[model samples]
Target: MINTLRANLANGIQTSSTRKFRSATRLLTFAAIAAFGLASTSSASAACNGGSTLKGRFGVLVSGGTKAGAGKYVDGTMTFDGACGVNGFVSVGENGTVNNFISVTGSYNTNADNTISLSLALPNGTETYDIGFSPIFGEAIGVETDGTAYATIDLKPQTAKVVSSAPVTTYNNATLKGTWAAACTAGSPGQVDLNYITIDGSTSNYGTFGNVTGVDHIYQAQFGIQPIAGQYAVLSDGTFGGSLTVAGAYPFGFTGSISSNGNELQYNVIYGTGVIEACIAKRVS
Candidate 1:
């Protein structure tokens, strides 16, 4: 986090301040697994151009890849040949249907469903595989075992709107135009007041400034020139920062967040000395 930013307004009295934030991109991906002798297509919500990929039949197809248990050709199907896996086995076809294997097999779509009906095919029935029944085990006796392997395939229509990990509700152009009392502070051990009135915004906002002369009359009971004034941006995380000006001189400003309720607006005022560092407020409504 940048913490805060400030720039002198050429003049001596006023200054501009900005709150800090971190802007970074985040993406997430995970894998799904299913044991032998099963169909492709997950039972979860995944978006794909219909079912276009095939799953298992663990083994060496008469003609697929040099890799073990890999599929071959575009036979509108592929099978799993149980090879080196936890519960290895095989599923054959574009629909990923197969029989024969071992333990552990479940599912998740290599591609799920679509809001529309979509498929990939040539103009003619120029694509289709013939059925074959050629099984080989040994000279006579037979022994078999199934295996397992996990795979993570990309869902079709890879574009997705990241759902916020948290819920965020919105409010209309509602106005907070009432007079109320509040108690506030500026630093670590700041003081609280007996009463103070709210000016603008609402229970959760930087609101508007204008208490007599815009100075936050935080203590309600104290009487003097206000220390800060200006527009503030309240963040969803309940923090705030912005600029403020005094009289007609160079605009002095602060950056901070709100606490307790709308009644308080604490900030870091950077002026001559290092800074006021922190401040606090409360609603006297």
Candidate 2:
């Protein structure tokens, strides 16, 4: 009878040991899965960099005016050192005077709202802007914050290497060779104009620089849709200038910038009269 009791106790102990072993195995498996999930999350966060991903060179466009009747338009290139420091060169048109290639220095930081704040020291004075970046990290839209000027800014990623000398990169006349869809806004106080344009950038067109041929469909209360043909040029630095003219319509000159990846462009119009104009173009094909 003692032998029989001993055997039963041994069997019970073995069963208990088996259950403990299974419980430990399950806990270890759970721990390993949690660890893997944590590691994956950390890697993704590092890649996104918390939306402070402003690095390398970017093409910039600013269009607007101050309250005091001085209109401002700018096309430039800004290079971020990836450490909050930045250098810029811009062709600025203010009032009736146009200055080509002016140098500016600045610093930038990202805000909680996913906006970047820039404090730039121009030759005239200091200016500040708040820029909201796109999810693709390739483009952004910004506004001036000083209350003195009403400005809208556009930023596009460029593949330029340096800003000190002429950039030797793939961003050239050929970079803009594609079909793009453009949306533009321009007007004075009571007369606003909205333009939807289709731009064809091809080498077969006629121009010293690369050719930009487009059809501008004007949407206004007076005219429903005017399919107007326009032509422009793409410079070595990816900026462009030309005119769009039609019978009984206003002939206006335009200046623009092409992104390094050849996917986007921004343009602004210049007229003798006081007007606000800007265009953003995205490649469709």
TM per candidate = 0.27, 0.62
lDDT of each: 0.25, 0.58
**What is the C-alpha local distance difference test score of candidate 2?**
0.58
lDDT value, candidate 1, whole model: 0.25
Question: How well is each residue in 1-285 modelled by candidate 2, as lDDT tens digits?
Answer: 334434655576444323323322332233233223221211112223233467766778887776766666676666766667667566566555655446666777777776888777665578899988764555678899978679888888765432233333544445666677777655433233444454555534333323344455555556555555444555554556555543235544555666765667776654535353666777777
Model 1 lDDT tens row, 118-223: 1212221122221111122100111111112111111111011113222122211122233433332222123332223334554332222222124444443444
> What does the lDDT read for residue 211 in candidate 2?
38
Q: Clashes per prediction?
A: 58, 0
When superposed on Cα atoms, how far off is each prediction in RMSD?
Answer: 25.9, 28.0
